[model samples]
Every structure is written in C-alpha cells, then in structure tokens.
Target: MMTRLVTDRLMMRRAQSTDLEGFHAVVSDFEVVRMTSSWPWPADRAYTKTRCVPINAAHGMAGPVLCKGEIVGIMGALSMYDDGPELGYMFARAHWGQGFATEMARALLDHVWAQYDWDVIKASAYDDNPASVRVLDKLGFHEVEPTIGTCKARGGDFPLRCFQLPRPPLTRV
Candidate 1:
C-alpha cells in the first residue's frame, strides 16, 4: 500500500520495496550522510530495510518525500508530545539548497495538523548545519534550545540545536 502527500512543490509517497536501491544510493553517499545521520557510507540493504523502513513507515504508512514521484527525500516526526511532534528530514545531495526541505517540512506539518490534530512539531540538526536551520526557519520553526545528545552513529556525544514548529490553533486545543 502507498500513500501520497502533496506539497507546494513536491509529492511525498510511501517508499516501496523497489525504492531500496535508490534510497540506499541517496542515504549512503558521503556528502549526504556524513554530517546528517553520523552514519558513514556504504550502508547495506539490511540496515536500511530493517531500521529506516520501519521508522518511515510508522507515519500512517507514509514513506518519505518525493519530487515528481521520485524519491528525493524523507521527512517525518519522532516524539509527538502535547500534539507537538519531533520532526526530521534528509534529502539527496543533488537536492540540497533547492527549497525541497522547506516544502516537505510544511507538508508534513500540514499533514499532522490536518489529519492528526497536532499542536506543534520539533526537529533537531547539527550545530553546523546551516542549511537545515534555514529550512526549518522558512517553515516557521524557531530555535528552542541547544540539545547535547549522543548518537550511536558517532559512538559519542554530539551538540545539536532543537527547533520547534507550532501548528495554528484551528487544528489543536
């Protein structure tokens, strides 16, 4: 089964079994995964399938962000508290700085508020990832605080900035 999401400039849909090779190509690139997941490249299908697939599928079976029906990226929330969800995204290196991230972020927010009645959404990025910060800003997310967290990928602690997006009151109490 596949679900589709329409953004101002992109269409997101459920990732299919056929997308694994393409998904792996995008996520395993050094330029794409280096500063993002803290996971180094040449990732195998097992990890991507077992870990990434289940995580992305949890959002009502929605997969990831796509452009023109092609998988360009992935965006979704993690911890949804107080109707505020923790958001995250990753786009192919070729799609960087193309405004796709912002478009997808807005789409995800819209989906959550319209379908899930969410109040707010949160996201975090590495302290040095200005592009991601800019994307969140364009989507109306504001910096809430600095989060010092540990990612198993790096096998150590890391410092990242947390951003939050508050949905309009029309959809939340």
Candidate 2:
C-alpha cells in the first residue's frame, strides 16, 4: 500500500500519475535540480514522470509534498548506501526559506523509525547549499564525513557533506 504522511501544513503521499505537471514544475527549475544528485539538468518531462510512480517498498518510500492540494516538493528515503537509506528532498525554488523541508522530513523520519528496524538513516548536502545543510541540522542529523558527489544536473562533481541520524532510543510506554 502507498504510504501517506500528514503534518500541520502539508500532506505527503506516494506520487500519483496526476502529480506529473506539479512534480515537473518543481524538478524543472535549474536552481532546484542543480543541487540534486540524480535529477538531470535541462529537465526531461519523461524522466520526471517516471519518478511519479508511487513508491513504498522494503528499501524506501517517496512521494510529493502537497500544500492545500498542490504539490510543492518531493521527499523520500532510498537505500542508496550500505549503511542505511539516504534521505533526499527537493522543492521548487519558490518554496525555499519556508520550514516545509524540515517539517515534512521530521514526519517522514518518525514514520520510518516507527515502522522499520534500521539503525541509521543517511543524508547528504552539497557543501555550497547551506540551506539544505541547515535543514539536515534541524532534523538532528550529525555530520558523518565529506566526500565528492556527482550531480547529473551540474554534470560534474561537487563537495558533499554526509550526515546520519541514528535511531532514537526506544521508550517504554
């Protein structure tokens, strides 16, 4: 079944076929795609459509972040590394500066921790993107290391800072 997460101001759920136009709008922006490691530059609608497939699997979950029924961003965690699932998110340039990233991420992480047995969740930010770094920090992710990451949009490598949030201690009810 597709997973859905609701926060005070946003609704996140598995991407649906209808979210194409909205998802494209967010992924098409050069400024937004440049910071993403996988999205290609000169955005392709076809590629973006493929990402709209509802994903809820053993490895990860992903979907669109909606506000008042409109898609504003995309967020998810994927098992891209051996240590754990890597958290990733992207928002339209217009949506930056709001606390949506942090809010949505916090909810998703909560769900993941409660539903899964993973011990650590990894994340990364381009060294130059302090905004994303701040989001990760706000989510309580600690810096793990620095490494070079390739951005398909930039078509080159850039300095990336890795981070991880270990599973919170279980509390007896």
Cα lDDT of model 1 by residue, 1-173, tens digit: 55567866788765556777667767776666655554545666676764345444334334567777677876666552344457777889888988888877676667667666456677788876788888888888889879786554455667889888777777852
| Model 2 RMSD vs true structure | 1.9
Q: Positional deviation of 10 in candidate 1, in angstroms?
A: 1.8
Q: Using lDDT as the measure, which candidate wins?
A: 2
Cα lDDT over the full model 1: 0.69
What do the candidate models score in CA lDDT, each in turn?
0.69, 0.89
- Which lDDT value does model 2 have at 133? 96
For model 2, the stretches where C-alpha displacement exceeds 4 angstroms are 80-83, 171-173
Candidate 2 local lDDT, 1-173, one digit each (tens): 56789999999997789999999999889999999998998989989989888775676778999999889999997674566688999998888999999999999988888777778889999998999999999999999879999999999999999999888899111
Clashes by residue pair, model 1: 84-120, 87-122
